[model samples]
Target: MTSLASKLTVIVSAAFEEAGLPADLGLVRVSDRPDLAQFQCNGAMAAAKVAKKNPRAVAEEVAGRLKARGEFAKVEIAGPGFINIDLTPEAIAGHLSAMATDARLSVPEMAQGETVVLDYGGPNIAKPMHVGHLRAGIIGDTLRRIMAFAGYKTLGDVHMGDWGTHLGILFNDYIRSGEQDKVLKVDLDDPASVSALFEDMSERYPRASAASKEDEALRAQAQEATLKMQNREAPYYEMWQKVKAVSIVGMERNYGMLNVHFDLWKGEADVHDLIPPMVDDLKARGYAVESEGAIVVPVKRNEDKKEVPPLLLVKRDGAFIYGSTDLATVVERMQLYGPSKIIYVVDQRQGLHFEQVFRAARMGGIAPDAVELTFAGFGTMNGPDGKPFKTRAGGVLKLEDLIAMGVAKATERLNDANLAKDMPETERASIAHKVAVAAIKFADLQNQRQADYVFDIDRMVSFEGKTGPYLLYQAVRIKSLLRKAESSGSETRGFGNTEIQKFGDSDIPLALLLCELPDVFEGALNNYTPHLLCEYAYRLAQTFSSFYNSCHILSEEDEVLRGSRLTLCTLTLAQLELVLSLLGIEVPDRM
Candidate 1:
């Protein structure tokens, strides 16, 4: 399963050591300019500087030494000291054939898998799902699946935002409006009523804030309710449970739509009891101090002597801020899972918050030194205006609205393409929805996680370009060809990869790309960026398209050549599906 570049480097690296130069100097990579060669090693120049010699002279000596290995057809010294190694057809075919029969395509699992606890999908109680939550849910969910596939035991949690002043606002508003009995006595099992109550509260929440701003009595009631809720008063606690229950309805439905789920619905309130002791412990350890009548735990940005604002643990009036609960949750998670790592798949806005929490946890001994904490922050899903996404009337777009928007664009495309015009109405509906979900997820996942991307439904669901639907359509085409081959009584499996030795020239490029799948996956995992995997998928799909257009598969007169092409097609389909599954995209057999 050694990569072509790695094998090339291994043989050449010994030459460097034999020549009394740096041994691991000639690290090779797939060449950017394919017209030149398949791979290039530019490390000789750096090695020359290190050894105080002419770079070209060093490269020539390295090339002379590499020639004994008999792998490269041509190892030419290019610009400065760049050594471009063109793999012999025999070498390329050997690797491709090896990959053809091997599962994992050549990517091996890590020697030691981690027990990871992933914190994501920060859905606030009483609030409906919004576009803001989409990234965390999609990214975290995909990471969980990928981690498991990569042999890590992953535990994904929905960090529900249940303990906050907002809870008090919703409670007081409902109690004052005299609709308390309807929520308590009515069909609590009805999702509609729960959703309706949540939606109504969401709408009135801002009004409640505005009213309380000028009204002292209302403000007092809200604060009192918050204190009571935290203190476990029967009324506030009971209403709080309803708040969480109703919110789960929306959370589950929206997350399910995106194929996102959580191992635990552990919210802020779950760690409430721990917060008091945790804050006191920090205070006892002198990590926490009183400042301006509030308790705060100051955290440093680094080992350097610079300092940022401290994380406020509690206000003067005894109501806790988010920081306290976050620190407590860290303690609780460590106690429960004893995980190797806890990755927080949050957006970039909370970058400072997490840094502070992690630091505070470590500073206060809440999180152990053995446990690794990572904040996998992503960018926002913005609208065309370059701000956070919104609807036609400039209101914040909900998750359901985004889904509907995607489906509509997909439906419009299906109509324009006249695709599946003969299909049943129900069948068309199902296909369009799958396309929509796939399109939306792919569009977001393709972008670098920390860079904001505009959400454009029309561009995403289009069957052309690098959209998800295009990939799905490509996969479908491969399935169709394979099915046709099988139906014609053509032998599909048991084709020896010996035929791969005959593929050269135009087909060589595709073969080379296919063999690099393992390296591409390793690079993606190393960086914690699925966009790397997305890039690999797009390139593979594009290369396979070129191969399909040039080399006929099912229609080829020669059975051996046809079988080789079919094998390539099957391998491409498997790897494409693997990459898509990692990015949380799905492919249907039919377009």
Candidate 2:
């Protein structure tokens, strides 16, 4: 199952050693100029610097050694020292046969038993999810899928903002609005009651927060309520639980629509108890000091080019802040999971905040040096005007509303294309949902994580061009082709037959691209970039389209050629499905 490029590197590396040159200078990659070669090795250029010999002379020596192996059809020196290699048709057929039989499509499991923890989903308890939460969920979920596929044990945590002064604000609002009787009488098991209570609370919260800024007395009442909840006072504690329960139900529904799930639904409140001891440990170890009346962890270093403020652990009133809970969450995760790496997928704007937290963790000896803490920061999703996305009315659009808009647009596109009109209404609806989800996820993931992207649903849902729907359509086309082949009794299972007489010009490019799938996975996993996979999927689909249009499969008189072409189609479909699945996109069997 070794990739063709890797196999070639091994052969060439041995050649370098046999020729009395450094074996490390034998790196081989897919040729940038496919018009001349299928693979290229520029190692001779670097080797010339070490051996003080002519690069062309070194390349000539390597080429001579390679020609004797018979694996390549052409071993010629191009330019000054570049080695251009063309594998024989038999060699390409051999590798394709092996890939067709392997279950993992020749991609190896690189991470084995390593453990990774992925943190995302930063929605607060009382508020609904907006477009701001979209990138983190999509990117983090894709990374988890990629890591798990690479053979790592990944733990995805929602890490919600369930505990804060916001809860106290909501509670104070509930009391002042004369709805205290509703909190006492509401049954948590009744969905109607819970839904109504949350709706009312959601509406009142903004009013309360705005009023608190103007009314000193109202602000003090909110502060007192916050203290009571933190202290676990009877009435406040009960109210907090009710609010948490109602909020989680709504949160799950919204997240479910996006097909985003988490193994840990933990939040700041989960680590509240650990904060006191963590702060005490930091203070005792001299990692924390009192700044005024508040406890803080001074993380600034002498080497820092810019000033970094201390991580606030406790406010002057003895209430914990976000840094305290985040630090405690790290301790909890390490104690429970013992992960080798913990990755935070948050907004890039919070880069300074994470820098301080990671530094403090290292200085306090809480996160061991062996464990890596990574901040996979991402940029914002903007509107057409190059600002953060908002509704037409300038309000933050809820995540569900955005999804609905996509689905509605997708349905309209389906109708315009006159697709799936004969299917049952339920099936067509399912296809639209899948298409919508794919469009939204792909539009977000296709951009580099650190770059801002415009959210355009119209462009994303198109069935042509580099869109998710286009990929899905191509996959469905392959499935239709396979069905026709089966009906005509064409041999589809003998992909291992290497006795084919010839390969179409287009066939080789598609096959060569198939061999690069593992390398693409490696690049994305190492760099934490899902857009690499997106680019690969698009190119693969486009390549297959060219191959299909040019190569005659069902009408070919040669049985061997027909079978070979069918095998290529089958492999392309499987790879397309695999890449899309890694991006958390679902492909319907028909649409």
Candidate 3:
């Protein structure tokens, strides 16, 4: 079914065409003023500006055309240029009923599906994931789920950082301790503890780095070991593999807790061999040149300006930078999947870095014109003090600790509410875990991805306001009623497939809101923002509350009216679940 806005746009477009004007100006959108109208066409003013006529006159002309059609119950031309529209009650009810039984819920899929490569969950090999990693993983996972639900064949890659100088720093620390043979052995059966190794490196790597600054010989030794590891020397390569295998255990644990997964664990080191060839191709194609003894791919934001420097592919000392690995990764993705779109979810701080990468890729013809490269940048999380979140010790907050903290807060709230006190221990454990994860994920996703949001466990797990727990509570409440209906043998067919020929005064508002889901969903998908879906879900739950409180469903004297209200409850629960899934939020069966 076409959206109401789309249908109105078609009608208005014809009017614009008949008036010998640009039809594009006749786009119809949801009215900003709810008390004024359900929908509005503001094209009159834009068209009037172009046609050199009065906006009110243009609106009157459009209103006359709209009135000739009997779909709308009221067609009013407000002051200046706005045309307010309210669909007939029958129209709204018919659309909503059709949506209830439709498998896809009247949300159309993309016209043609494309192969997509999504890069996210980028935790380096040695370091622990922090709240900063939380933002990228959550946003990228939601986008992946939404795009896949809309029929795109997507590949989620972790894009690990296993091949950088960070490895060398750790290696230097390991070798200087004089336990080289014992540590170099690859224990694939039972990997070494990553946290233990990280602790060791955390203490010693800085000292090694500091001593290397004053000692050129030590620096040279580190560089030599890095080269040997890259060149696949027996001892260094085995140690490298061991480090990679163990580090991934911690990485996967964090991802599993967040319900995030990657189809490919390809790291920067995976494309190491490809970089030399790529650099050679760039030089041959005249897209790269030698600058300060380093091979570089020059990128400029403006043709007349050269503020930002070029991307360094190879350092003078013969080492590949992260940018080089990124370029090789593009070529690798193109060779394997030939995706139409490659989306990167990273920090907004990396805006310039991605710009440099994409431009360099396009200049070198690594990304073809048909391939669309998009970087969805997100803001950082902050503490209540409005600074970047850190531990009391002024260290980075580990993601695992954050999860544990969320669960603790949720459990306290759940106990305080005295909910499910007699439930089995296993069920309560499951609820606590789900609520904790939901609180963390929802708190991050409820705001626009580009805007920094304060991290607060209390607010997130609260049962009131626009919190994840509240949405879950609403769903659980509906389930309780539906169970009650089943026990009483009350017919609920009114909610499944039956169309309403009439509505109570209180039902019209919800019916209208339900009809706008397709438009809201489409907008959210196009804008690459899940917060919009959060908004629709919250407003829907709020409306359902009003409907439940004021109108009697299970206790109504009129059987047909009661069944209709039951159906409304069922549809609300379904839409709420669908949006929550889109946002990657979990709803418990019980509060």
Candidate 4:
């Protein structure tokens, strides 16, 4: 369905075109100042510049032409040269009827499709997922949902960090096999075992990474073990499999808790076999050049360096860096998925690295279209002293701990409110849990993804202001009112059997607010801004509050008036639920 703004734009364009003027001068928009009218057109100013006429005269002439048609409830020329339009009651009522029935709420889906690959939440295999991975998970998941809503074919790839130099370090440490006097071996199933393995590996890897720290025979054995694992050999591959399985299981718990799910979980190991041919192809095309003892792609460097740092495809010792493997993966994706755009949701600190990879891809001529790479930056969750967020024990905080804290606070708030004391304790607890999750998601989403925000549970769980709980509260309140009306036999009658009440006889705040739904969805889709829906939800809540306060739903003396208000309330609740759902929030029946 065409929005009111678009319809007006078309009408205005035709009016000017009929007058022998360019159509570009015609534009319509929601009013910046609501006191003037519902909509305002600045086309007179643009038209006057080309028509060689006075601006006020042009506006006056257009207003007269529109006035003769009687399409607007009120039409006037204001200021220097603007046409203000007040939609008639009939027009608003008609539009609202159309919106109430339209399932998409006038938000159009894309007619042309684009393929997108979103790479996010790149966590190493041996390490615990931390706050550092938060932004990628949230932002990328949100983007995936938005793009799908916009009618695009989107694939979310959790590019697991499974293969890298870290493999070599782990291999060396395991092969040492000396002084193995511990009575119990590390178990991957237990959290403590997993934690200790990571802690011990982190402490030992840097020392073993040095050339002089190990004998030639030990280094050779390490390399052999690394190759065996990569080739899926027995014992070595079995051990690596256990590590990958355990880590992935742990990571899935985090994603599930966050309401994040990936369409694909392709790992670096999946592309390892293709790396050799990719390097050969680069050599054949001269994109790979011999530099020093290693094969590299010589890149431009800063003024401080006399020699440009090569991409380092092959180390002097014939080892592949991540850059080479990534280049190979790009080729594989181009062949397998054939995406129009590739969006990497990696960290902003890797900006230079993506630049190198993109340049190398263009040089390789593997893609017919330019690959679009996007980087998202995140700030640390700071403590009271403004450093990285940490526990009272001065250790890194786990993602689970943060979620648990938010839920605990939300439960406390629910108990304090004493909401639904009649309901079972189990049900109340479940409702509280949902509220907590919604609160955390809403707080994280309200801010711009690029900026860092303080995750305050107290502020987030409040049932007032622009918080998620506030929106949820409004929804539950509407449901409560409707349920009350239903029990009292005051629910809205079918439209055909009901008489539409006069607009001026009662408050029309909800009607006024209803006009903004199409505008809100349009803004969100175009700008990729869910906050637009957040604002719309808050306004709808505020409008409902005003209506509830000033007017009586069940106490109305006239049947039609009460019925109309009931209809309005029902529609308002539907819209509130719709917009909140789009923001990835759900409203509980009570509280």
| Global fold similarity of model 3 (TM-score) | 0.93
- The TM-score values for the models, in the order shown, are 0.94, 0.95, 0.93, 0.83
Per-residue lDDT of candidate 1, residues 442-500 (tens digit): 77788898898897756755656887777887887888888887788777442434346
What lDDT does candidate 1 reach at residue 69?
Answer: 70
Best by lDDT: 2
Q: Write the per-residue lDDT of candidate 2 for residues 318-418, one digit (tens) a residue.
A: 88888998899999999999999999999998999999899989999889999999999999888899998877888777788878888898788767766
Clashes of each: 0, 0, 1, 0
lDDT of 2 at 53: 88
> lDDT per model, in order?
0.81, 0.87, 0.80, 0.70
The ten-residue window of minimal lDDT in model 4 covers 491-500
Candidate 4: what lDDT? 0.70
Off by over 4 Å in 1: 213-217, 301-306, 412-426, 492-499
Query: Which ten contiguous residues of candidate 1 have the minimum total lDDT?
Result: 492-501
Per-residue lDDT for 327 in model 1? 84
TM for candidate 1 is 0.94
At residue 13, give the lDDT of candidate 1: 80
lDDT of 3: 0.80
Write candidate 3's Cα lDDT for 1-591 as tens digits.
757787778988898878777898779887899899988988888988899989988888878887888789898989888888998977777777787777777778873678999997777876667777988998888888788877889898999888877677667767888755444554556544455665565566557777878888878888777777787786778878877877788889999988886889999999999999999999998889999999999886676464777998998788888889988999999999999999998888888888889999999889998899998888877878898877678677778888887777767776776666877878777787887777777778888988887866457555467777778878888988888887887754343335565678788778777777778788777777888888888998888888878887778777666666776777788888888888787777886
| lDDT, candidate 4, 204-311, per-residue tens | 555566642457866676666666666677665666665676678778988787777689888887888788888898899888988788888756645534443557
Q: Considering TM-score, where higher is better, how would the candidates rank from best to worst?
A: 2, 1, 3, 4
